[model samples]
Target: MARSTAMKAAGLILALLIFTFFSLAASSSNNQIQILNAERRIDLSSHIVKVFLTLKVENVGTSPASEIFLAFPPSQADQLALVKAQAAIGKKKKKSYVHLDVNPTQLPDAPNGTKYFSISLLNPLSSGETATLEVLYILTHSLEPFPTEISQLESQLVYFRDSALILSPYHIKQQTTFIKTPSTKVESFTRVEPTKFAGRELKYGPYEDRPPYSFSPVIVHLENNSPFAVVEELLREVEISHWGNLQITEHYKLVHAGARHKGVFSRVDYQSRASVKGASSFKHLLASLPPRVHSVYYRDEIGNISSSHLRTDYRKSELEIEPRYPLFGGWKATFVIGYGLPLEDFLFESPDGKRYLNFSFGCPLAQTVVNKLTIKVVLPEGSKDPSAAVPYPVEQHLETKYSYLDVVGRTVLVLEKKNVVPEHITPFQVYYTFKPIFMLAEPLMLASVYFLFFMACVAYLQIDISIRK
Candidate 1:
């Protein structure tokens, strides 16, 4: 039979080339798993703030890979559900993934795969698999120390992570040196590892898996008279204008995280160290302004900043700013602030009517040597089909006819980012597409140049005598 139909068409082309090489090795092993590594640690002496995610799966199939899923974006799952509900109410117990809410179809029942509870994996992950997951959270008003400290004036404290506070009975006792026996060499509470509180609360450690760049070297000589301000760095900008206005800018760089005063700084030993109330070298910083912002300014870079102090409320529109030297302990400062508002309080009018604008700003985490930072956004003269996006890497430029008078110059959007930290200031966004004939080409080119100079002064009064001369 003609050689068995040519050997059954060569065995159906070798079984379609072995099913296209196992479908490209199962799509390159699901694109080599992913995530690889992620970290966020803020311990500050057991106040607790840890987020570490590392994943990598590569099997190259032969048969042996089970399951894998990792996805967290809703503001990093609400900062890991407020650090697992402040470490389960400071460990009174009741931690079922502590108030879980990590969306995305709740990722196939997370347990060891942690999809954020609501039906964890009973068990089953065997193949050519590779796994590793670790999640620990605890936030509850991180730490504080502003009960009392006078020395040279300046004190204030309040930093929350998984917060709680209620201290008031005085008789303080938590020192290390400066005379107070029972020595353990005060290596800062022997590198922390204590918990359980009440009567002015004091708890530390639910201690599970402790190993993400471990830290323990404490220091708390309370009765802090106040003043150890540490801003490190801060830059804020909110710009939006569709003619209705809304601009608020702030730039600050401050330091003085305390502890280190050997010599040189003795105004009569700081006026007798502020009369023995002791523990002072200045630190007072505060900010809270938002109410249809108005013309409020504070400058630096060699200008304005006469030790700053402003309080406003032009009828229910509040503002309170205070700053002008008093941030001692390795002192350093920088400033800039501005305000103006009314862009319909951050534009939004859709339903097919188009027009949207949103903004957020504030970043300063111990001055991480910012190499560069630039942001220039001006839209609404004739906003084209623009869609600006920046989560870090950006470079775009386009220009045409730009001139100002009644205005015709608009559509300038420039964004540049580098090094950036401080949690990337709320995912920047800028989109456009507003063209009303570029606002009538600058008022019709200034009324056609004043009607061609009034027809050249009525044709120069009917020119004639000029030739006879």
Candidate 2:
């Protein structure tokens, strides 16, 4: 027992030594890097909040720096939807942008449970070397409705909260924050110092010599009447047929995510005074679709809706649709959109003789957020070894779907994701193995049914063993 206790004590000592070493290393690395200049522009022109950040960073220490960390409070981190970064190369006049990899990471010594995402540089910055990075991040459901409830005639107002300084682990020399609202009708804003308000734009800072993790919270209240379309649930089904066609159907349960509507709605006032009445309500939405789409249809629970138009070109198709009624704050609608496409465009054969279908994921509607999204790819009967290749992380599983003339049912690959945004609308591929002979199953079944029906008719007409005879 004594020997075991001594061994355990020794292990604890070693672990403590290792932790101390790593902590010191991280501290040293943080001290080595600094931001020369930083600029942030917050665009609050719509329901969605978009932030653009530009940072000029340099390695002031004697070591190389390969990654930079972005700091965000826990509240904002939950609302973050998309983050993309690019690095500038060459001179200013003739420069190109290269994409950088940004991924969430955990650090043990983070203060106040701050979340961090590390942006990896293509090439490490040596001592005294500098690099410029441009980052664009999108946040959804970030704006808070001021009153939380409003009348139809009342215009919408929201509150946006953010930091005046750029949140970074490294020290910053100079930084500035600019905020642009939808209209010049600003209600109120929290001024940090050295702040300027001109028209619809608010400028904050040019703060200099900020230490690491410096933050100053600011809130802005402004007028914004843009539609806040949020899809509570969306299910997209893609059925592949080897007979030269691909079918896609999408079901949506949509809601207005802004302030709730109060009192009774006046249709007469809304129709006559359209310019001022129900300014916060929306009735029109647009969807972008692929080229050569056929048999496109849109409908709601009440049946086919005629208030829709489709424009097609060689490049792409645009679909404009309006709900049966204008969607006010807290209003809800359910609908479906379906279309068919040429199979040759989306289906392809691999070198290994496997078949795959390339299709777009996420809701087709523009500037909308989906709380829950489910994509189902139904493969033909007799398909085997089904798999999915999505660019991002998603919950994937297999299911069976029985269709017309299906004996063993079609194999379905289901991919589920939450908090889906417009940025999630990317191409995803579903791969499976299918034998050509399976194509004849439905045809043979139909032929057999027709032959049996003919034989029964012939016997009924020609045979003499009937009860009536």
Candidate 3:
């Protein structure tokens, strides 16, 4: 009897111990998973402004995971650049691991529980990991709209969602203003949802997750008649020469996103509609270029666009380009523009001893979808350790190249993002190390040729006249 009792007690103790151990393990596991807390701020005091975004991620898991990563929205990524970091998953330390990938064909999307960054834990995480990523960037406007439509002449309005507004560091009470089209009126705005700050966010509504192909319809009727312009794709290139010239080129496809006209355009009706300035479906497209950027030309796969008139003033340069045919609903227009600048206009030596190139240009899109955009910036010959970064939201390092007129064929930085609006055209900067020898080679070569020509001329003059003797 005593032996049996002792055996029963041992069995009960073993069961209790196993249950307790599992409960603790489960609790620990729950605690190890972490989420990212992000805070984004935009300061727009000057034409050039800085965007600072901070991300804090915590891990709550029992066993150590190999890695963790965070993903950013494709649109936001185009305008952001990773500047500094202090990241770690375990006792093992790492300098940086975050990367940006572009899906130009789709809007920015991320799965739940997916981290924007990844971390490798050292001592398999008994607890969780905590990390913070900070990004600093300069924002510039890229989108342009041609205010002509086919059917009804509508007043254009640029809509800035209250959600996209970021706080400024300089002011506590006053926030940065997102200026809308001058003629637009704030008809009726509402905040259906809560925001980080009260009275700031204009919410649309809440939605429940539905199956694929199921779309819940929510219509917002504001003064926003501005043709929903979107350049689904844009390719912008800024080539630098330590040797002394900056060449800028851009290729883009734009589509009309506003309400479409039903039937063929009638010129007589269009002429009469002109009296009522805001009723026609034709949009007058315009692009703003840098004041110093000249020799502006516009063309597409078909050929040169003759209807374009490029004008520059002391303050700014403008390109007024008209399509071969009036752009109706769902119409697409593609064109390329090229211009040049003295290298001295934007390149400067950084305090860190690296040469950096700074330039800004405009990219405009009508209200249509941009499928893909590839931007390639060519660096001059003899450039070493070339690296390029942009301040706009985008996917990065899509491809690298070594091409003509290049010592290293310049670093070709390509950015692809989708569903981009016109107002998002922001300036991007590229920084790299330059070789000084390249700066003088061309000038010296020219001087040597001139000197040799002069010497040869004098010798020929002295020897030729004696044929008579």
lDDT of each: 0.43, 0.92, 0.50
Query: Model 3 Cα displacement at 455 (Å)?
Result: 16
Per-model TM-score on C-alpha atoms? 0.35, 0.95, 0.49
For model 1, the run of ten residues with the poorest summed lDDT: 163-172
Highest TM-score model number: 2
Runs in model 2 lying further than 4 Å from the true structure: 3-7, 455-469
Q: Which pairs in model 2 have colliding backbones? A: none
Report the number of the highest-lDDT candidate.
Answer: 2
**Higher-scoring candidate on lDDT, 2 or 3:** 2
The list of candidate 1 runs beyond 4 A from truth reads: 1-42, 45-130, 134-141, 146-323, 328-378, 384-421, 425-429, 434-440, 447-469
C-alpha-based local distance difference test score of model 1: 0.43
Better of 1 and 2 by lDDT: 2
Candidate 2, 1-469: lDDT as tens digits: 9999999999999999988888787788788999999999999988878899999999999989899888888879889887889999998789999999999887667889899888999998999999999999989899999889999999999999888887788899999999999999999999889999998899999999999989888889888899999999999999999999999999999999999999999999999886589999999999999999999999998899999999999999999999999999999999999999999999998899999998888888998998899999999999999988898779999999999899999999999998888888899889899999999999999999999999999989997885884
All candidates: CA RMSD (Å): 18.8, 1.9, 13.5
lDDT of 3 by residue, 119-145 (tens): 343334334555554544433332222
